[model samples]
Target: MGRIGKTAAAALLVLALSACTGGTPDPASSPGPTAAPPATGAAPAAATDPAGQVSGEAVSLETGTDVGNGRPASSHDGLMVRRRMVIAVHPTPDADLGALRRQLDRVAAERGVLLSDISPDVLDPVVLEHVVPEVIVALPPEGTHEEADALAGLAFGPVGSFTGVEHVHVGSVLVHDLQFRIGSADPAALAETIASEGILSDALGNYSTSLDGGALTVGYTGPLLSDELVEAVREGMARGAGVGPGEVELAPRSATGEGVDLSAEPEPAETEGAHASGRDDSGH
Candidate 1:
């Protein structure tokens, strides 16, 4: 499938799973199996905040709504499933945190979205440096095209100017099973290989490959990231570096970012045969 097709399929799968599970997956931790709830005619339960306040934010659209036979609800169904998203704001010369929060709150209220949490340090240190003054927003999941459109309007509309937003990301989950570290010995070459190999590039929309603490760290945004893709990246990196597969390790990451653009084509230098000069100068 093409990149857009693959991304759409992954998004559909995530929404389906969300509908079945009754919520979006926790980005911080993996979920364990659970027993089926006892059959009851009771109305679906509403989410409760520890503070006992509704918080007036758009919760998950899928919350408290169930589709029969464990099937996901159709986009036409007006169910709102709460999902997480992160917005990275560029720092301005005279940035005011309070004013920014108020601006964000006003925007959320206008759009009926809940501004769950806002933090400046939620991003990886590497990503944090480039897109400092960031904030993570947890609002309703975009299960339907309408929801997605609303979000795009919010991100790219008026608020875009306020945050000086770098990007908006949805449904980003950090992988824990796969971990890898690049040593000081060859961090640049290794990072270059990982970026150019097409394995990691194919699965991620916006990503950062940088050296942190004398080791290479990679952070990316996308919903399609899977164990299989992780393994493929590991294997490809191993081959490129002439190292054992075990040498590649995945690192723990927190979710962050907004508006994953899967349609973006990788730079020519980051694609296969990028190193080759077009001319066959060698004498035939």
Candidate 2:
């Protein structure tokens, strides 16, 4: 129905699918998707879809950049299609996001994530009027999960303050050292809420859930959260890893072997655009 409603519905779709297949039980005991229980005597099939399409969860994938001479250079093909969301960043007036912009660009290239809009030149601008890009897949290269997580944490700084929105739970996920960790919110509960409860959805709808065993195992590299939210993060990570909330073992330190502050980072300068710089009027 609405933007927030759509996001919420998407979340429900994830949880419902998990329950139908007995994937993961909701921690809150909320009603989830319903499907006939797997036949008692039947062996689990090769986990194939009718069309023989393999599920992403069953496969371990690593996306790479294409430096091709034969193919065209556009964001429409390859890993770009796998993207599911977009984040547009613009700079504030009298403040240049040059450093931050470069960091994002480098992170995107390194992680297999894509950068949708805005250019390098506009990164150091005075204002960004209107710019929105669809997000999909990791941008940073492989082997930098923690770094990517930290960047995601910073990227979601603005939206993190909202009451019902646990920005990290729905934001970017990172892969690191072959271990899965929740990188966004400090308290894993926020992620848990996002995973367990359809905090963003409306009743009576069909959607998909992305938090299967496969989604949870993805690791992250990022900054720490406030002391208050760290435990939530631990719980959230455990859930993502399929450990369940009750079975989680939250250490004082993070899976990345570091600490984080839950307090929000200093607000990015207020500019006219999503990027730290004002929006660009020049036609590209």
Candidate 3:
């Protein structure tokens, strides 16, 4: 090619490059979307197994660190055990949860809902007060109905012992608060599908439901309700909702009775060497 022709071609190329580069975004300015807020349920995708053991929910409950331990249990065993109930308490309009908690404690004390009954692991009695004020009470497995009666009385009876409580939700396998974009599918329908259409299986009638704003949370109360089973239901719900795996933003699965924290599962001790020194396991 001639020198003048080559220079003109190079100039054209530079102009084309400049046009293409005009819309190039700065990496620092354009960041990827952050992960969804952590799930409170905290269970494996495969934990939907029907264990026939209703132990209640295990909460990977994450709340603010400001509010202190609400009358924690005396022993460490309390922290390790399963949650008997996830009683979500709704307070009166503009009421302070901290103050409501204090009032609930006093009322519970008076009603004989012992501090030990409520799981100490879940900030004791009141699990979540910041966003959704909730309470936890136990109807002991071996303990008589009288004890259960006492808990029910403290929460519901005596005509408002714990004042300022506007609403209450009782569940075992708590689906954590969820996040839904403006265009996200409605999860509220999942409850109707699960309840009316037979999704609970053996754990049916053992679970409870709670609706906070746009989020619908289902928790199990029966000891047979396992975290594995909860995950199954969630997956089923997603399928029913006509959404893909990650499309429907269901919260993490946590149960009351017995739960195997899939995230915290221990590695097999007998893994030996992942790869023998300098030796590839894959056939070359």
Q: Residue 255 of model 3: what lDDT?
A: 26
Candidate 3: tens digits of C-alpha lDDT, residues 49-147 = 123332232211211111112221112122122323334444566657666555446645655454322321232112222223344344332333223
TM-score of candidate 2 to 2 decimals: 0.22
Q: Mind giving the per-residue lDDT tens digits that candidate 2 earns over 1-284? A: 23222322111100000001112223343222111122222232222232344322311111111110111112211221111122233222332445445545664554456653311111111111222212222332332433333344333233222122111211222111122233333334435555465322222112222234423222222211122223444454455445665444322212323221212212223323332222121111
Using alpha carbons, what is the TM-score of model 1? Answer: 0.37
Error of 1 at 95 (Å): 30
Evaluated at residue 236, the lDDT of candidate 2 is 49
In candidate 1, stretches whose alpha carbon ends up further than 4 angstroms from where it belongs are 1-4, 7-13, 16-180, 254-284
Q: Write the per-residue lDDT of candidate 1 for residues 215-277, one digit (tens) a residue.
A: 666653333334455565667667767877677766534333232222231211111331133
RMSD of each: 18.6, 23.1, 27.9
State residue 192's C-alpha deviation in candidate 3, in Å: 1.9
- What value does the lDDT take at residue 189 in candidate 3? 68
> Which stretches of candidate 3 lie above 4 Å from their native place?
1-137, 140-188, 201-204, 224-228, 245-284
Best by lDDT: 1
**Which ranking of candidates, highest TM-score first?**
1, 3, 2
lDDT scores of the candidates, listed in order: 0.37, 0.27, 0.32
Q: How far is candidate 2 from the true structure (C-alpha RMSD, Å)?
A: 23.1
